[model samples]
Target: MTMDELLHDPEFIELIKQYIDYLKSSVLEINTKLANGEYHDVMKFGHNIKGSGGGYGFMELTDLGKALEIAANDENKEECQKYLDLIEKFVQDKN
Candidate 1:
């Protein structure tokens, strides 16, 4: 189902909203930690997103998160930035 449809449904709307908030917070946290040269939190956040996105019916996000996790683990800032950019694009496109 599309995001609009999900939002239209009373049951899923609140959950979706919460997920969006989570995504926003996750992004901010990742950015902060990355700026501090901390890869662990970035990896942790990516792993959480990878595991939870599909549960929220957002497999695309899960894919991006997986890429982010891998990049962070490898300490590849460029690759991690690429994945983070993709994730931001995904969020913008979806919302």
Candidate 2:
């Protein structure tokens, strides 16, 4: 959806802010895990991100998170990093 269409709901926007905070925290945790080679935790984090992003109506983020989750599950570190970058870009552009 376009930014104008997505921004129409005040309540949703508020919820999105909260979710974005959660996303940021989760991203940090995931980064820490990845840094330590804790791949399973990273996968779990990506799964959480995917669910929460979809719940908050950030479909692009949701898709990116899903791809990350899948890549994590498959032990495809490069693809997972790509998806992570996509999600970061989406969040940065939106905010």
Candidate 3:
């Protein structure tokens, strides 16, 4: 289905809601992982979100996820935090 149609569909909307909720809950763990130098886990999480976000019609999330993934891959803590903050803000703005 087209993104517009998926956004209008109740089930798809619910699925998006669930995805956001999962992201919300993961924020803390992600932050903790970052603080601990667990870049691999963070990269994996980012990759998962990057893979799934656009499919759910949240291209912003996909973009942020890509940034996060790249930052994590580089092991750049500051850049990772920046993208993480953007992701959190995006989630807040969406809801």
**Which candidate has the top score in TM-score?**
3
- For model 2, the superposed segments whose C-alpha errors exceed 4 Å read 1-7
Report the lDDT tens digits of candidate 2 across residue range 1-43: 6666767878768878877776666666776666677778878
lDDT of 1 by residue, 1-95 (tens): 88668758887977877888778767877887887879888898889989999877889999989998998999988888788778777766666
TM-score of 3: 0.94
Q: Candidates' lDDT values, in order?
A: 0.83, 0.74, 0.90
Which digits, one per residue and each the tens of the lDDT, describe model 3 over residues 15-92?
Answer: 889988898889779999999999999999899989998888778888889999999999999999998899888878
lDDT of 2 at 26: 68
| Candidate 3 Cα misplacement greater than 4 A, ranges | none
Q: What's the lDDT of the predicted structure labeled candidate 3?
A: 0.90
- Residue pairs whose backbone atoms clash in candidate 2: none
RMSD of 2: 3.1
Return the top candidate by lDDT.
Answer: 3
RMSD, one per candidate, in order: 2.7, 3.1, 0.9
